[model samples]
Target chain A: MDEFSFINSIKQSTYKQSTLLKGVGDDAAVFRQSSKDIVTAVDTFVEGIHFSRKTMDPFHIGNRALAANISDMAAMGASPVFYLVSIVIPSHWTEDELSQIYRGMQSLAKQYKIDLIGGDTVSGNELTISITVIGYAACGKARYRSTAVEGDIVFVTGTLGDSIAGYHILMNPGQFINKNYYYRRHQMPDPRVAFALELEDLQRVALNDISDGIANEAAEIAEASGVSITINYQQIPTSDSFSQFTVNQQRNWPLFGGEDFELLGAVPKRDWPLVQQAAQRTQTMVTEIGYVDIGKELVYLQEENGRKPLNKKGYTHFKQVKL
Target chain B: MDEFSFINSIKQSTYKQSTLLKGVGDDAAVFRQSSKDIVTAVDTFVEGIHFSRKTMDPFHIGNRALAANISDMAAMGASPVFYLVSIVIPSHWTEDELSQIYRGMQSLAKQYKIDLIGGDTVSGNELTISITVIGYAACGKARYRSTAVEGDIVFVTGTLGDSIAGYHILMNPGQFINKNYYYRRHQMPDPRVAFALELEDLQRVALNDISDGIANEAAEIAEASGVSITINYQQIPTSDSFSQFTVNQQRNWPLFGGEDFELLGAVPKRDWPLVQQAAQRTQTMVTEIGYVDIGKELVYLQEENGRKPLNKKGYTHFKQVKL
Candidate 1:
């Protein structure tokens, strides 16, 4: 199919939100923003770099791409209203494969009540999907990574390390048994949007989503907030599926493996109880993994043996080196 | 550089507008919107397809990519507030080359007083730049392609065919003398944002950007508005550089060549004088080349002997065939 026909097919299955005034066919998409502030984030998923065709289905590829961006908005405690997706498809891919990708995106968009408003599709050597999500928040309420204060209690929502463990299982399917739980975690990460909104309403001090590993993201919050963070390695949350792995694998995965798409934030110690109540209201699991203190070093890990500096490293694009 | 350091480098050079509440380091960028409506457009430039590394500089590539999206917003008569760029670079490329590309984008963003808000950079097999521009317009002011009326005068901003001619010159540098003007036009087609805002203020019936050639765009306007548009072949605008080419080349290029990034719209004949006055105020050159009439044929070309059907074909990816 040609570009026009392909776009028409996409439009047929696209979900339109009430805020979208014009979509698809116009020179640009027009939408109305009713909130006091606009929240925007963009993430690009490259085949082979982010996922491999051999390991991932087209549906999962699309779902992961949009989920990555949605997670960013959730990190800011915003409700995503619309999103635009730009896909670069390889020549060998069939039209049916492309439609499947769009269907995958449509499914997630429907769940979030977000309108697929605009995008561009082009031919390229490798498949790459870039998604930009536009969201809304109340004025002065959107969470920021740079707002943590001394004595703030660091908290994380949901379990971690499942994504990386799932990725490994998908990479070597024969090596693991009953990998569906981990695989689904990797393929369809649930962005903590509703939970984050509850946190925002409770007025959290700082927030960030763990796209990178917990170590790297905590370091970011620490550096941005001009404070230091210390986390007890034993206190880190991990799923039952992840715990089934070897001890070393479980430890390394929660600390350094990225793409968890879980929320990490800080709340004043005095407000910790209220924060827990908010999490309960949202039915989100909350774990107190660390605390913020006045110091220069960004992050530290308190293990059973001793305390050590936490290296802020996760996935690096070009170096092809793991830390 | 790793992704963190690479992102830091971009943060140092990025220009932040006053409306931006947060940028870069946060999970998402936050910006305030004062306008009643938001306009968004996205365009992707693939290395070999939209350009070639051997012929075009990284600066021009970045400039062109952002310009394409800006032109889309301009077509809707929106004032661009900010833009996000997602770039996938080949591993063989150096850090300096990527920095140069960002600098190129910065230059244009500065020209329009828009912020480089948020984006993603990943490693891929080919250089691909996808830009999403966010603009704003007063409620009920943004123009649409589906609003043209019978007796509306179809108009085009500036001369056409220059971009394609310039592209030819760039492709074969030694074949043409005085190629700089055309080459620059091809590399950096000015997005008529200011002029389009003026036209919109004058309440033009319809508007479109000529990225897909005037013929195809006019046909789009006609199809969307359910009216017939007719243009005199002899009246088509061509720059002096374009006129230096052969008659057939000039004729065909103006009709079928794409990537002009010019504006095309329709003004009701009664408001034609007012629209021309608005263009004059904006110091924009506009040529009336056609009229919208009550018919179903979409588009027609008026030749010296007789009128003929104007085929709606332009640059279609994957088909390698030029209309």
Candidate 2:
């Protein structure tokens, strides 16, 4: 199909929100903000770097790409309203494959009520999908990563290591039992948008998405907030499938395995009760994994022996380099 | 360099606007809108497709990518405020080369007062830069392509064939005279933002960016507005370099060669004087190229002999296909 026809096909089934003043076919998408502030993020997923044809279906690739951007908005406690996708497809791909990608995106868009505003589609040698998510937050309500106080308690929503374990299962198919569960987690991550909004209502001090694993993201909160973070090894939440792994794998995966798309945040120590109560009300499985302290270390792993420096071994795009 | 460290390096030199509540190192960038509505657009430039390393410098590649998206915003008469860039770089590129790309983007961002907010960086086999621009437009003031009236006069800003001529110069170096002019025009076609705003102030009926050449964009205006358009071939603006070409080259290139980044709009015939006066005040050279009429033909071209159907042969991504 030509560019215009492809755009028309995508436009025919789009769910337009009332806030959208103009959508597809315009030079630009115009929308109104009902709130005081707008939160925006862009994420690009390359075929081989972020996913592969051998392991991931095109539908899951599209789903994960949008989910990653949505997760970023979720960390800000914003309600996602609109998204623009720029996709470069390989020439070899079929029209059905392209439609599957859009269908995957529509599924998530329907759940979040996001309008697919406008984008560009091009043919290239590699498949690359970039999504920009625009969301809204009320005045002074959006969470930040640099607001954690020294005495704040650090918490993470949902279990970590499942995505990484799922990835392992996907790559080494028959080597693991119950591969479906882990593989699903790797392919489809549920962004904690509603849970993060609940935390925002409860007035969390700092927030970030764990796209780069718990240890790296926790260190980011500490570094940005100018505080020290200490994560108790025993307190780290792991999935039931994750528990089937050996001790070393369990310890390393949850701490360093990335792409979890979960929310990691800090709340004042005094407000722990309220935070827990809100999580309980929302049915969000949040675990208190660490605390902030007045020190220089970005993150310290508290084990049975002693507190040691946490290894910054999570995924960074550039190999053998630390951010 | 790792993704985080590269982001930190970029964050250090970024120009943050006062309206930006949060920027790099956050889950999402937060900004405030002084206007009632927001305009957004996304465009991706892929290696070997939109540009090639053999013909264009990396800096020009970056600049052109951002300019393309900015032109979309200019078409809406929106003030470009912020942009998020998601870039996929090959492993072979050096830090200097990557920095040059960022520098190219910074030059345009500085000119437009757009803040570099937040985005993701990843590794890929090919270089792909996708930019999402967010701009503001006053409530009910943004122009739409679907609002042209039957008796509206169509105008285009600056010249149309310059970009395509420049592309030819770049691709076939020694074959063209005044190569610098054409090459620069191709690499950096100035988006008519200020001019479009002036036209918008003058209450222009409809507007669009001429990224896909005069014929296709004019057809878009016609189709979107449900009106017939007639073009006077003599009235179409051509750059000095473009005029130096043969009559056939001039005709075919301007009509069908894409990537002009000029503003195409419709104004009621009665408001022509106001539009001309506004354009003069803004020092923008705009030419009346056509008229919207009460018929079903999307576009008709007037030559010396008689009127003929204008072919929709502008650049579309897929080969040998029409929308």
Candidate 3:
């Protein structure tokens, strides 16, 4: 079938959200304005740079692309309403693979209760997927990195370092002893959208998703909010599978290895209980690993040995090898 | 170098839109909702497929990417508010070339008064640009392709076929005597956004931008609206430079040539005067080209010889060559 025929097939689905006045099949998708503020984020993933057949299948690639953007929305304490995907497909990709990629997104959309409003699908040399996710939050309640203040307790939902371990195991299958749990962390990440929506009940919070790991994300909050942060390395949570990794990896991965898709945020000491209740309501793991302090923009890691400044850095996925 | 700085570098933009609570530094861009309905469109342009360096410079490529999405907004009779550009850069591209591309989009953003929202910039094998433009229109007033009804007067804004002819001139320089006008049309297309905003006063109308040429766009309206459309070939507007081409080229270019960025729409017969007044006020060249009638979904083109059925098709820019 022709390209237009393929794109048109997606819009003819039975699902249509009530808020969307128009979806696909139009020059632009139209939606009625809601009462809440709007949150939008765009993320692009290229085959050679972001994913490869070794680490991810077609479905996994698509799922990861959407998950990355949804994680961004959740970082802002917003619930996704709609998403637009623009994909550049190579001629070598079979139609089944394309359908599988779309099916992967549809599956996540169903879970998030978000509609695929519109997108552009075209031909290209490499598989490139860019997704723009739009979400909504209570008025003036959307979380930001700059919202962190002195005396706020920093926290994270879910165990960290597992996804990075999973990624390594995927790249080198036989090296790791425990694989399935970490592999699932890499293959399927549950973005904390429901948890973020629940956080809207609180008075205030500052959030950043752990896509770039806590070192980078926490530094961002410190820099933006003009505050200092100190995290206790011993208090950082991790799964048993992650703990099985090398000591260096156990320490480094949680701080430097990204793509965990977990929520990293700072809340007032009083609101920590509310956040814990929110996590309980969403049935998500919650842990307090850090606290905000009054100082110049700096992030320090408090280890058993001593306190050390953590550099604002994350692992790069832009590999030199082409897939 | 710290690779995490990509997000910080793009955060350099100092956009001053009041509605924008947060711009680039955050994981998601947050904006206050207005009274109008929101219109959103996403378009992807890939090197070797949608365009090549032969027909466009880096700046022109950037400009065209934003123009295509803005044109989609214009077709919906919406005023652009903000845009997010996700670009995949190849390693071969220099930093200056990348800056030039962004400058291209910045030039147009200045004209359209739209802020650059958050987007992902990553490394890739191809230069793929995916832009999502968000706009707003009067409540329940955004025009649609399916809004056309029986006895509506069909029309188009601005000269047709210029951009495609310009595209040809860019591809085959020195082949055409009239080069600059067409080249400018291809390089710096002024999306009819301002003109579209002026048309909001009208009671009812249907619009589809002529990115895929009038024949394809008209057929889309006919099919979507479940009406028949007939256009007289002699009445279609073309510039003197366009007319200098071969008679066959002149006929085919206006009907089948795409990327003119003109709006082809239908309105009730009584609203023709109102449309003319709006065009006059906006100082945009608009002309009557066709009319809608009750029939099975079909489009007809009238010529000196006879009338012929117009197919729902447009030229594909997916050339089989890598840049």
Candidate 4:
């Protein structure tokens, strides 16, 4: 199909939101924001830098792109409502592959009830997808990275470091046992949107999505809020398969193996019970891994040996730069 | 500079909009929408596909990217407000070039009183910049291409053909007599946001920003609204330098050479006076180029000899595909 016909077939189904007056067939998409703050973020994934065709299909690439941006909205304590994708296609990309990419995004968007509002498509030398996610939060209630306060309990939802372990198994096939488990973990990240939304009623909370690894995200919170953090290594939750990996993998992957799409949050002690209740209601695994304290801005891991500063830089082989 | 520090120096000044609760240092930018419908669009510019470093510099490239999106908002009869830029940089680009590119966007954002919210930056094989612009219009007032009605007076603000004329001169240097006029027309587009916003109170109006040339844009309106359009060739406006171009240039450039960033609107004959007053107040030159009629969906241009079908596809030298 030509580009216009392709656009006509782009939408998977009619959207349910009455606020979305216009979708794909206009100069711009129109949506009414009824008394809420809009939270939006953009994420880009390039072919060679972020992924290769050998490990991920076109569907997964699109899924991964949209998943990352939606996770950003979840991190801000907002209910994701709409998304736009701006993609750069190489000359060789087939329409079928393009369709698979969109299908991947639509499938994930369906889970969150998010509308695929509009986007831009262009031809270039490599496949690059940038997704912009817009969500709504109650007035002045969206969480921020710089809002972590002293005495806040630092916690995370879901297991940490699975994506990195999955990454290792996928990159070097036949090197690890139980392939499907790791494959799903790396390929299809379940964004922690429901868990993040559950905590919206809490009075004091700070959240950051784990696109970067746990250690790096903690450091960001520390740096942004001017608070010290200490994550107890033993308290960090992991899967049963984590024991089968090498010690180096166990030590570093959970800390630096990014793309986890989990929520790392900090909440005051009075709000901790509410956070825990929300996690339970959402069926998410919650673990109290650390605490915020008054000190110089720094993040430390409380390992068996002693307290050691967490490396702010995560795994660098795949990601070169991000902001 | 590294990406993070570059982000620190990004803002020209702290944003003035109180509705923007949070700006750059969060998981997402948060803003309160005061009962207005949100209008948003995404536009991407890729190296070689859109423009090369030879024809346009980094600043002009950034300016062009944002201008295109802003014009999309204007086309929908919305006021341009906030913009986010996601850029992919090649390894060879200098920090100075990247900064200049941002300087271009910041300068334009300043002019429109728009805020620089947030974006993603990454590395790739070639430079790619995708911008998402968000604007607001009164509830249910956002216009669409599908709204042109029969008997509406079709109009356009400003001259149509300068960008294509400028593109030729810039590509083949010293061939044209007036260099600056054409150069500025191609490099710097004055988005018709002011004139578009001026028609806010009009009872019935339809608009489209002139990005895909007058012919293609009108065809879109014609096809979307299921109306026939007839544009008088003599009625199309042009600059003084236009008279010096070749007959073929004169014939095609005005209809096919896009990126003028002017507003093409359709309004009821009764409301035409209000549109004219809006144009006069904004210092924009308005022209009655055509009329919308009930018929088979098609677009035509009437000339001295007779009426002819307008080519739907515009100039193909610079742009390959856009949606």
Candidate 5:
């Protein structure tokens, strides 16, 4: 098999899908959507930088890249229609690994009903994966960070920092035996696509996905909306794996160590109950984290102390060390 | 510094001059063209698989990825408009390299009269770049690979294999002393945006760019249009680099090597004279390779052998070779 054969294997499958008007053979994938065709998101993952070749599996890397980008689409309250992927792999890789990566991507894409319209692959210095996801939303209804209200309640889906912990498990496999949950979190950070699609017309749900940890992403929403935020530390949801870490380590990881592809949202006070009910209808949890307020700074409610300024920051590529 | 700050520093100069409805801060970019609507194309480049860090500089890799995709719009005879780039850098890279890569992309974008709209940046293991370029073709005309006819004279812009030779030169920089031409070819393989825009109503002139070299791209156009192709080897435009290589090498490099981002087109035989005049007007040469025939084989006309079967296939990713 040759590189074109490998790329064509993917193209052949995606090109014939009914939803794609134009696919692998063309300059761009063209589609017709009922709602506004205004939203598109592109995300990239590099080997050694995003994943360790020594510890990470190619299948998981491919699945993770696709999932992370789709999560971005969900954050906008948009329904993803199609995607274009670009991959650069080291020339030395085997066909099996390449096929495994595609299989992983196909698995998630099937679940989301996302049509993999087109992508490019060529030889490069390292392995790289980039995916551009296009989604649709009703005009004027797509969510944005800039629209959060001063008195809105903040919500998050699932738990936080387990994906980071999964990385830890990969780095030190002997230390972790909770393979089922951590492995799932790292390989498949759920994109909340159905939830986003359902919330498109709700008007009060301002949404974003947690790519750069909860605190960092929340800070973006707060800054964009020109409002202060307050998080009750005790209320921040966590899974058992997350809770097992030392207090300072947990706080730091939860606050900064990103790559947590969870959905974070804000809703008006009046709509909170309705939003929760809506999630119940969809069979998903909507955990309340905190509230938005009219002020210049974010505050953390501590049990020992009344309140204190929270350092609202997340993973920095330039930072020297990790939590 | 935090992740947000890193993003802000990198976002400082990008899209500063763009008439972006919403730029990097938003979920997706919003832009309008004179045609009142838009068309988009997304292409991604992966490291170690598409290019070699040892052979290609970051600036050229960044610039060429953008330019090659823009050429896709050019093939549609579309005017360049706006682009969104998603870059995944290795975690170990420095700020200087990132800025330089963007600078290279921005420089090319400025020349093409397009805006750098919005993009997402993340740290990954291998470098991956995905760019979705949005451009406009007058409502009724966007050239496609599926439109070609018997007797249409095949035409190509610039020379083939120069970029390939340039890659070779870069991989072994010590081999050549007079590196000016090779260096330029490696860094900037011109996008025929102006030439493509000139050939309006591409129904009369089916077109595709030569990203995967002329032979492979021509085969694609032929296969898509259900037409047999014939190319005159003598008529294939060549550069000084062609003279340095063996005849077999010249043929192989021009036919199979990827990264030659030139334009491959088909125009009416009757318009041959006019095409020559237009080439002169644009100061870009248009070499007539061959024409469409009745059957399915892609043939080549050699000086001594007259018409002969062209059997060598172009570059394929599955070919077993060590990087």
Candidate 6:
């Protein structure tokens, strides 16, 4: 079928939802909710820039892209209602392969109960995915980073650096012989959507997803909240493979890798017990990695030595791959 | 400065807006609007895919991408409030060039009264610009395209086929020796922002942006509405040069050329007078290109012949570039 016919077929499949006043075939999709609308987030994932075609398959790429934005919605302690997705795939990709990408997206949308209300598809030189997720909350309770006061406990959901190991295995299979851990991390990232929603009324101080590793994200919250962060190295969560590859694996990979897709959140010192209880209720493991301090810096509180300053460089697009 | 520092500097410069509970630095930017909230639109302009690196500057490309999404908000009669722009530029690109691109975006954002809330910068193979424009409307009266009836008259805002002509000249300068209309149309086609806002409360039956040419866009609306449409050849508006290029341009180029970015709307017959008056008041001309018919086909009504069915092929990313 022609592009128009293909688009038409897709449009016909869209089921009407109560919140969505309009869907595809309009300038913007309209929504008709009764209460105060709250938080929204947009994230774009480009093939070569965000993920390598050599390292990631179309399905994982699609899932990760959608997951990245969904994680953002989760971070805000809002229930994701609807989303718009725009895909720009290079002409070289087959329609069947593209359909698989959509299949992956459909899986996540179904899982999260977030309706895929509208989107755009176009041909381009490289594959690019952009998704905007709209989530609703009560008037003023959406979570943010700036609310992290000094003495707030820093917490993270899920293990980090798995994606980093996964990337290494995906990109340089020969160099890193074993494929299991790295591949798993690269393929599937569990966005802490359930945990985020559960903590909606728990008075969590600040929240953010760990897209660009824990250390970089820590620095971000520190800067935004104008508070210092001192991360206790022993408290940082690590997988078995991550621990095994200690010297060669770059222990800081979890602190700097860009595609972990985990959630890093902060809770007031007084509410740490409540935060811990919420994590158990959501059936997700939580790690207390650090604490907010008075000075505006990110410091690594090493077990052997005293505290030291940290750099802001994360997984850089250019440094990882040379043109 | 490094990429992190640059981003931090930009973040530091941002003034806190009370409407935004959280801006940047977190998993997502949170907004706390009074009555209603909506996640808006995002458009990506990648080098070589959306524009020729040789012809279009990064600045214009950035501005245009933002404008495209802003135009979508206007189509829904929503005021653009915030935007997140993620840019991926090659390592070779200077910081000055990057700043210039942001300068273009900043100027337009300021003019539109939109805060450049947050975005990410990364190194990549080619320049990529993606912008998500967040906007809001007062819940009830946002326009949509699924409401068009059989008796509605179709109207289009601004001119068409200019981008195709502009592309022709830009790609092959020798072909179009004279510059005036060709260059301006190629560089910048004004998005009808004000006109769309004026369309509020009109119960605009169906609406779409004419990014793709009118023929293709009309077909989309008709196919979506399950109605037929016929365009009067004499009533179609074109600039002097558009008419001049008819001999050189084929039916495909005029009908299928995308990037017009005008608004194509279907209005009830009774609202036609009001629409025309609104257009006149705004000092912009509105052309009644066609009317909704009973069957499901796009027939171009020609004076010489009773009716000629037109092909619905518009600009396709996969299609071979003609120029």
Index of the highest-DockQ prediction: 4
**Tens-place lDDT digits, model 6, residues A27-124:** 66666555644566677677766788787778878777788878777777777877777676777899777777877776777787776766667666
Q: Any runs in candidate 6 off by more than 4 Å, and if so which?
A: A4-17, A33-37, A53-55, A167-182, A240-243, A247-250, A315-323, B8-19, B33-39, B138-140, B169-182, B240-256, B316-323
lDDT of 1 by residue, A149-233 (tens): 9999999989888888888888766767558878888888899998888766566568889988899899989988999999988
Kindly indicate the candidate among 2 and 6 with the higher DockQ.
2
Please give the lDDT score at residue A131 for candidate 4. Answer: 91
Tens-digit lDDT track for model 2 on B15-85?
55777888776888898875568899888888877787776787888888889889988888888888888
Runs in model 2 deviating more than 4 A are A1-5, A12-16, A175-178, A315-323, B1-5, B12-16, B175-177, B315-323
Count of clashes, each model: 0, 2, 1, 0, 32, 1
**Highest lDDT: which candidate?**
4
TM-score of 2: 0.95
Worst 10 residues of 2 chain B by lDDT: B314-323
Candidate 4 — which residues are off by over 4 angstroms?
A: A175-177, A314-323, B314-323
C-alpha lDDT (0 to 100) for residue B201 of candidate 2: 56
Taking chain B only, the TM-score of every model is 0.94, 0.93, 0.93, 0.96, 0.89, 0.88
Candidate 3, residues A197-232: lDDT per residue as tens digits? 898878889999988788988998999899999999
Candidate 6 local Cα displacement, residue B202, angstroms: 1.6
Choose the strongest candidate by TM-score: 4
- Per-residue alpha-carbon lDDT of candidate 3 for residues B1-323, written as tens digits (9 for 90 to 100): 33444444444357756778888778888998668899998988888767789989999999988998899999999998899988888879876787788889988988888888878668878888889999989988899999899999999999998987887777666667668878889888888888888888888899999888899899889988999999988899998767578788887888888888899999999999988988999899999998998998899988889988888565443221100
Instruction: DockQ each candidate and list the results.
Output: 0.54, 0.55, 0.51, 0.60, 0.30, 0.34
What is candidate 4's CA lDDT for residue A8? 68
